[model samples]
Target: MLIRYSKILLTAALGALILLVAINNVTDYATNYQFVSHVMSMDQVPTGSPLEWRAVTSVTLHRLFYAFIIAVEFSAAALVLAGAWRLLLRRKAEAARFNAAKDVAIAGLALAVGLYLFGFMAVGGEWFQMWRSLPDAEQAAFRFIGCAALVMLFLGQRDD
Candidate 1:
């Protein structure tokens, strides 16, 4: 029971954190947008590098990318929070039932991991050489990925 409660609380906490992040991204659009824009533009990458061709210089694409990221964040937050609610309601149910309720939370965490790992790290960090110009962005994405992945693993465990 204590373990169940801890799982539920951790899920809720992660959901809240993601929710806050989505809100922050929406409320402070330009700030995050700039980060995306810079990463996509690859202006921070060393000039004349072999991979310079990978830079996306289009502002339209930048906006689109940023919009997509924000949308994913909102969706993940919703799923995670909803899953947490389901877990709370089923906290006292049999282990199988409680475990079944974890599906939604797992989906949310997977989405978050994909976004940070593939979206930021693979596309922006490696493809765009963001590490050269914006190592902090890569680090931030790593942190998010790590947190979400940890919660996912914890939630995947059977209650029994």
Candidate 2:
């Protein structure tokens, strides 16, 4: 039971973290948008190189990408919160039933992985070469990915 509650709490905590991050993105839009713009535009990276062509300088596209990122984060937050609620409701059920309640949380965590892995690492890091940028944006993405992945591993453990 203790382990079950711990899982529930951790899941809820992950939901809260994602929710806060989404809220921050919405409330403090320009900050992360700058990160996105810089990464996508590749302006911070040294000019004159074969990779220069990969930069996406269109303002419209920058806003679209930022919006897409926020949307995914918000969705993940909602899913995880719902998953936490489901777990709370089923905390006392048989182990199998309680385990079944984890699906939404898993989905939410997977979305987080996708955001950091696909959006940040693949698109920004490799495609746009955000890692090569002056500020090195890859670190932040790696941190977020690590946190999400760790929580996901913990959430995947079966309750005895």
Candidate 3:
């Protein structure tokens, strides 16, 4: 029972977090959009480096990338919310049956991992040199990724 509730709580919390992120991305669009713009354009990177060639200077691409990120965040939120509800409904079922219902939550976690770890840390931080920006967000990126990983680990445990 405890394990079942734990899994449900973890997923619910993750869902709430992702939903808030999506809301922020939508309501505060210009702020993060600027962050994306600068990162993609590599304007914050040190001048006179050969890596400057890798910058994507186009505003259109920046908006497109930011939109993609928001979409992923929104999708993850919806999946995890529905997954949490599913877990709640199946909490009293057999362990194997309840565990089998975790697929949606797992998919949500995967999307979050992809966004914070692969998308921000790998692509934006390393590829676009976002870490070198004057106001670097790599720390926050790592933190978000770590949170998702911790929740995923908890969710992966056997309910039995």
Candidate No. with top lDDT: 1
| lDDT (Cα atoms) of all candidates against the true structure | 0.92, 0.88, 0.90
TM-score of each: 0.98, 0.94, 0.96
Q: Across residues 16-118, which tens digit of lDDT does each residue of candidate 2 receive?
A: 9999999999999999999889888888667678888888889999999999999999999999899999999999999899889999999999998899889
**Error at 108, model 3, angstroms:** 0.6
Local accuracy of candidate 1 as per-residue lDDT tens digits, 1-160? 9989999999999999999999999999999999899889989777878988999989999999999999999999999999999999999999999999999999998998998899999998899888987888899989999999999999999888
Clashing pairs in 2: none
Per candidate, the number of residue pairs that clash is: 0, 0, 0
Say which prediction, candidate 1 or candidate 2, comes out ahead on lDDT: 1
> In candidate 3, which residue pairs clash?
none
Give the Å shift of residue 101 in candidate 3: 0.6
TM-score of 1: 0.98
The RMSD of every model to the true structure, in order and in angstroms, is 0.7, 1.3, 1.1
Query: How much does candidate 2 score in TM-score?
Result: 0.94
Worst 10 residues of 1 by lDDT: 44-53
Candidate 1 deviant stretches above 4 angstroms: none
1 versus 2: better TM-score goes to: 1
